[model samples]
Target: ISSLRDRITTLNSRPALDPIRIGLFGSSGAGKSTVLNTILGKHFFLPVSGMHTCTSCQVHVSVCKSRYYEAKIFLLSHEEWKEEVKNLLMLVESRHKNDETDNDLEHAIKALKAIYGEGAEEKSYEDLMKTVPEVTIPPSRVITLKKTEAQDLASELDPYIRNQDGVVNSSPQREQMQLWPLIKQVQVTLPPSDLVPEGVIFVDIPGTGDANKKRDEMWKESILQCTSIWIVADVERAIGARAHEIMVQEAINACQVGKCSDITFVVTKMDKIEVEEYVRNHQGAMGNITQHTAILETKRDLKIRKTRALKEKMMLRLPSDAEVLQKQDMVFTVSAKEYWNFTVLTREETEIPKLRDHIRKLYLDMKRNQLHDYLQEILGVFSLVQAYHSTQLSQDPPMRQEELQSCLSGKIEALKAVTTLCFSQMDGLLLKGVQSARNTHKRNIEKILM
Candidate 1:
């Protein structure tokens, strides 16, 4: 009976369901923020300059429940901030002594400057620690906009979430205390939109390669929590060695630990190609086509070739058990700029709508599965209770108490067997259906291309 009570307690203690998190990752100039903005159907996230990353920490964007735009900025504790400063100073000192490559030192210096004004790296560790109390411990971490426009919300969030760009902050106090470098993460809530489904969160994760160990670990933990991951890169450099390294080496390592079910490779800036140069190089491919037709055809052809190449690389690098590369429609070549500007590509040609639909479908599917699992657990508990009550109410219970206990044990084992068999059968049918759908989808895409 105690064992049964423990089991009941465990079931009752199950945590509340969290929204399905879709993590988007890319290097500094990979157009990750642009892709997220396009998906949200607004310019919510500020696009970073080519030189630096604005997303120093994870930014979780979800549909808001209330009228106002809400932002909860989580900050590092005082002790945590102190340790982080120490680590950055160590990196800077190591760079000076060893005369190593400047990448680590540069990032460290930028972080220090963002926290303390310019020329912060020159300060000793003790001096830097003294200044930590002024900014590291914020008065309040949450900021909300009262029924403001998207632009207004973006402006309010710029100082807390964005890196120190040349744009001067209107608030001198905000400039004096750069909140972004000290932020652990930022959660932004926006109004409901057709693009972002209910109970779906889009996390814009910075690149995994960071000089900060704490940030790197946070990235890994975030990757493991994602239900789906979108790996973004510039279309021109999607197949470069660095892109592959991040995709196959860093991101894949975390995904392999489970939680992540889908991985899609997105190549942005498809509209930035030089049509004349492309046509001249692929004259045979662009034979007898108008300039407009040639450009569209070139983009389509590049997407196909790049998709094939990416799949081949994944096959070579990924372990045989990996399921990420097995999914159909895993590659998306999108031009967020063209989607909004409509200069060269149509809305459909940009592929943003398709990506948005994919995200919604993932959320719907996850919710459906959660409902099913919840019902299963409920039914299991009911069976256990019914079994116990039925045994207790037996007329011959006094003489056959031992038999009743044995009977109860048998029912429990039978329940477990039934649940296992049902799950196995369901998994088999789902796999078969998914395989058939993938084949049909692949053929349809080929027909459209032809």
Candidate 2:
């Protein structure tokens, strides 16, 4: 009776609610941060450094009830920090040996100096290894600030979150610097009105193609946790061979074998393309083609061509499961910079709102599905409890035992039937979805191959 009551208590308790996560994944400097900033309508909070800025995965969320900004940073273990220090020192030494004209190399040296002091350049590899902490502490720490206005909050969070200029040498900045190199994760919660929903998380992950193995594992973990994934890129580089390879290697390859859902492709930096120049170069005549007219016509032509090219490239790369790729309205062109600038030409043209809507709907759908599954499990538990109760109420012991055994067998058979039926339905649905994706892929491939 106690065990049965405990089982009932377990069934009645609410299950843990995991937040919906969306992952923005792509190559370094691929305008991924821009896409996220645009989505959140926040500026400069997420560091938009050109080269390997995001070294670890950062998950951003919003707390509707809280008025202040909060950041929970998860630092790496001492061993991990030592490894990161080794990598940074090696890069700095290599830069010192290599070309003196490279600005990136200069930035790397300055960043290293900013963290390790002036002598950082002269430190031997073994000396740098010894510089790491002798003891290991808990891998995470939290920092909270009284909530300020959106713009102000964004500015304040910059030092704590930004990659390029985040590290400083002040006495109080020691902990921040020590943790920055080994930061495995950063969780930031904004105010209620921020673009981040109360129960949904947006993860900003470093590119998987980097040399850091720990961070690469974090990137893979982020992908596994995400409910939706967006592969962001600059419009000029969207369908490039490297872009295709990354998408296939990081996303499509997973979808081919795993329970992968839809993946969206976002082409950012649309404003960078000079429509008039493209029109002049590609079209037969550019004379008398008014700027606005040329811009409209060129954008239309470019979208059409890019879409075709993207489909062809993806199909070629994912020949076996091309259609699954096509099922998603995967291509989105955006100009996050222009959207924030609010210029006449760029104002209503930004598709950030459309993407936002898609995410909102996806979140709702996920909630509904979760609720359905939960209710199904609850019903099963209730039915089992009901059978146990019915058996307990019977007065005739021997007859009741036989009756209970029969009842148990019937219940087991019924449960098996339900399980088989559910599996069959799911299999049918999965097959149908795959077939639809394949059909879409085939149609797009036909258009391109012909």
Q: Indicate which candidate wins on TM-score.
A: 1
TM-score of every candidate: 0.76, 0.67
lDDT of 2 by residue, 111-144 (tens): 4565565667578767755554422345443445
lDDT of 1 by residue, 352-450 (tens): 999988887778767886778877877887798888888889876465678889999999999999999999999999999999998799889999999
Please report, as a residue range, the 10-residue window in candidate 2 with the lowest summed lDDT.
133-142
- Give residue 182's lDDT in candidate 1 (0 to 100): 71
Distance from true position, residue 173, model 2, in Å? 6.7
Q: Which stretches of candidate 1 lie over 4 Å from their true place?
A: 1-16, 99-101, 109-136, 139-147, 165-177, 208-218, 249-255, 287-292, 302-326, 398-450
| lDDT values, one for every candidate | 0.73, 0.64
lDDT of 1 at 90: 90
Find the candidate with the highest lDDT and give its number. Answer: 1
